[model samples]
Target chain A: MQKTLKSLSNKDPQNIILIGNPNTGKTTLFNSLTGLNQKVGNFPGVTVDKKTGNFNYKETKINVVDLPGTYSLSPNSEDERIAKSYLEETNQNDIIVVVADATNLKRNLLLFTQIVDLGKQVILVLNMMDLLQKNTQEIDFKKLSKKLNCPIIPINARLDKGVEKLKEAVFSYQQKENIFLDSDSSSSSIDETMKRVGKINTIVDDCLTKDGEDKSYLFTKKIDNIVTHKIYGYLIFLGILFFIFQAIFSWASYPMDLIDSGFGFLCDFVSNILPKGILNDLIVNGILAGLGGIVIFVPQIAILFAFITILEDTGYMSRVSFLMDRILRQFGLNGKSIIPIISSTACAIPAIMGARTISNYKERLITIMVAPLISCSARIPVYTILIALIVSEEETYGIFNLQGLLVMGLYLLGFVAAILSAWVMKLIIKSKQKSTFTLEMPIYRTPRWKNVGFEILSKVKIFLFDAGKIIIAISIVLWVLSSYAPGNKFEDISKKYTSETSQQQYSEQEISTLIASERLEHSYAGIIGKIIEPTIKPLGFDWKIGISLVTSFAAREVFVGTMATLYSVGDADNTMSIREKMMAAKNHETGEKLYTTATTLSLLIFYVFAMQCMATLAVVYRETNSIKWPIIQVVYMGALAYFSSLLVYSIFS
Target chain B: MGKSLNMTLDRLKENESGIIKQINDEDLAIQLLSMGFVIGEKIKVERIAPLKDPILITSGSSYISIRNADAKNIEIIV
Candidate 1:
């Protein structure tokens, strides 16, 4: 009968579901089983999707579905609902892998016992066994297995221990275990159920000998005393944040410079070979320079994600959420809102999507509304360049660089703006529904470097791919716009500079630079910039900035690239860095320096509040499945940016 | 205790009980309902999954899980 059941399930590729509470090392187990073969997708008719991966255990090809981490199959959130539905379907899963945290076995068993009664083929995995060793705690696995009437394997997922035993248990899985609940009609009452559970607890106690004291709760209380204390907690959190930003600035510089120089060399090499024509000029000046401008900032973005991934993986994020909950509640947000807010520092799309975790509709809406206000990674390039241009490197307050201080100020301003806006929205959109914030503070463990590395690489790849596509297309268009115009002397000038005798006579730098400038001034992009000159003039922006503004709608980081390309026109040999080009720029009409401190400040403030990217808006729409919020976001942010820039420009000018 | 209130696991209030007849919600709902929730399965109210929201119930079969806010909508007779 067991063989017949196995064969029948095998004919349909039985779905082996992995279920566990949050922070049980469930994801690590999934990674081990699937390696890089896993794919994430949404479940049918539900926004909360399932992540399924394939692996072969013995001769059986198993399709493993990694359910979302939940304390129990309580349908409070969308994630929980999706997880519960898949598990309840009798025919859906052939076996269930219940990953439980060994350190907190009492609470973990709350879910394990439930799975046992479901009559599903069960493999109980005691994850984080290493943490038990660290805490000097031991569990009798043999007794645990016997008590539960299921195979139990102790695993240290972080160290990849006992995984083979887990696989072996899966291979040797049998359906004959008498783990199912007997339908006793006499004990159908609530009192009877409680009595049975009490009796089971007695059985559990008899079978297992718990050793070295349960210090998990005590440890949490001790840590919470200092970390979540009102005044000191806030101070420590601020201090940690300050250090992270400082590290991002100081550590990323070396790699950033290397990338910049490498791209510069590549540009020069292309300029050397391509025989001084439109094709050569486009490749070296337009494409390479535009891409290099954004590529140089990748190191900083990657490092920022690395820190975030570590914080999230080590289970510190929930504690941070718990600590911040009280403060956030004051602004119509919950402690849970911090996740989305922090994620928004990378990009608002995912951050807004993350708002779904917040159970309260009103709080979730407020989070989504205000998330875009947090300066995202796209804004980083703009901020870095602008701060470098305006703020000197002198130390302030005896410990912080003036540039670093300015960057910090911008981040704080965004956060302040987000909170203030949320507060206002709360007043207008009143919700009387009672919302509770209950978060499980998971045990802290050393971050698995593999997961962190994978997260960073995936995010960086996504950022690069999305930004690269837009930059390349816009660069080509800008090249065409700046290269030719009807009845213009621009083409004539470019040809003359590239003519055989003139090209040979003139230095390579002079020849390339002349062709670049001529092409840009006559390109289609230049015409559009000239047309928009009137509109942007009041904000102290030139036609070059107009072109940049247009391109930056795709992504804010493209502003730096647009400026690089615009300035590269006049730069001899493309030798000057973006900063040097910006510093050298002078207004053609006014003859005043284009990137004066006032203008830089104005640009910085403009970018601080602008809904500059169409991509972010698209993502927001997709994530929320609503056009209303994204449209409102764009209009409000655009107005804020314009008026703020106008205010700064007027005051300074 | 208090008239020995009898209600179905689904019909139980913010803190009520009835045997889970069928779990309609997916993912979380199913997981919570399934732990000890099967046809004709008996359950007792434990606390809730925090926040006095989802009711935590222990099934007679030796497992505990939470039910939805509307879980009280289910009918039961003692």
Candidate 2:
């Protein structure tokens, strides 16, 4: 950490702090200023994202730290608290660039004036100047600059207009002593804030002139009338959700397939080029396989985040919160929790991170805890292979495809489980913070595609690097466990398979597969599976299923791959071959056919409820800043999965 | 009779407009004041949610959503 600070200071980049109210395009301005040269880090002791970047002007590089958007220095949430503390700790030389919405100058200046009273070097950049002009409202920024004793630059951040001038202003910033309110004027903070607003209102009225009436938000209000309508509002939200789901599952699969094959080719190339040995096996099967699993989810995550960003950028997200607040509050979730819950269907890593919008600590915690309960895209493969064991793909009941209906039923079960769990958590968790749904409803506008692109890039980067590290580490460990045997057991199996009688009885490919399966049965993971068989037998899962469950902790979808390995199925993708093998198998004691309806349905229920994804748990730990929450999540969800599967097995049998 | 005369923002019907009187809750008042909800400002209830708890209100060019629990804290003049 000290080394990083030294490297950062070595550049001698002048500090330019960016602060603003929400929906003021402060982040858009930061992106324009820094371009692609930015890094997201955590604040000193808090989990709120600290976005820092640098831009070069002429010969000097200027460092910019984009603080979280806040209404005033008096914070309402952890995010705002970080912004306030960071501002209070700023060096005298650092220039505070307050980005204000040009259309709503009165509220925006509340923050600007607060910073000005702090007596720091400050620059006020009026963003959304185009909207101001379109509304026929004029801000005499030149006069306002003199009146407020700060540099005022009008720039449209979306269009990147006058940004250079804003930079030039920052480059030559001069500190001034301007206080919006006297220190001892009011007894309470509310009175002080009101006094400040009164002062700002007078200053704003003197420097602003309007022609006719402000109509910029009139169009938005009209759209809101329909979008927020009692019946039409819900229908529209559902329609959009349907479209997004289709794009994630259907459209994202094309790119996902390309990535899958690309990784497969890479693995093949590496394995072929390197000589066969333990090192080669570790590289090909351990590291590369783990990496391949992670990269495959990128397309789906990117698609989900892109749609979420667009929805948020166009200001539809706040309206969604307004519509969902009352209903979700009963579950101890805020309306902002809806985005994270919906995003959970694609992947919970991004969804857990998306819960940052919920300011209330309890609500955000519950949202994160229950998000993984929703069926994600990763569960699809497991559900498909398992469901196919009982019902064929073409089988249907009446008009609906039976297999498809089961998949839908599993998804609905997951949703119900998530909501119910959240309700339970709401009752148990204690919090003193007052829950409030005070959110700004920004006017609807075209999404800034550039910002959306940047958002996807950053979210994917966090998933790939932050969560990716843990996933890869866990994958290598699982590989070692399943690849190596306790002692000479692996050697003994290979030698037996190479004997003349065995070679004659089986073809070369069949012999190798038999050796592989036998070796796996004696391997550490397989032994662990055996040890847990008694515990899981009531749920209708045998030792082989136990092995898959052990491996599935790396990721739920690994159940399919592990099943193929244990069954000696050469092609893991050949679900038919594996299903046939599983169908023909028998219980060693009872001599009854395995893969019965009871076992299959029980396994399906298990996969739906298990907290088996390490990547998601790692993210939950980071987001909650506690190992305790993720531990509680695993314990509760595991118990739920166990009992639910047990109940299903009894009913089916 | 006196209780009926003391109007709160939450009691205002959809499309009804009210002038800011005082916010009983100190924290909510500070938050509202920063969001341009001054004591003398005119706030209009643009829409009430279908569930009728959180309502959308616009004061000047600033629009926001607040729950009825919070709206009950703000005294207003119809």
For the second chain, the TM-scores of the candidates in order are: 0.47, 0.91
Please report how far candidate 2 places residue A91 from its true position, in Å.
1.4
Query: Once superposed on the true structure, which residue ranges of model 2 sit more than 4 Å away at CA?
Result: A1-12, A277-280, A346-365, A376-411, A429-434, A542-545, A551-601, A613-628, A650-653, B1-5
Model 2 residue pairs with clashes = none
- What TM-score goes with each of the models? 0.81, 0.88
Give the i-RMS of model 1 in Å: 9.0
lDDT winner among the candidates? 2
Q: What is the C-alpha lDDT profile of model 1 across A1-653, one tens digit per residue?
A: 24456557646875678999877888888888877777666677544546788888777777788888776644556577667777877462378889987766655665666666666677888887766776676667787677678888888887788988877777777765554345455753343334444555565566555456555545654565576565676788788788878877778889998998899889989899789877888888789988998788888889888888888897678767766665687799987899989888888876876787787778988998899889998888989887877765555657776677788888888889899989988887788865656555555567888888767876787778777888877877776666567685675877788779996788987787657655666667777888998987878888888898888988898898888877876664778888878887778678789987768878888888988878678766765678998998888888888888888988888
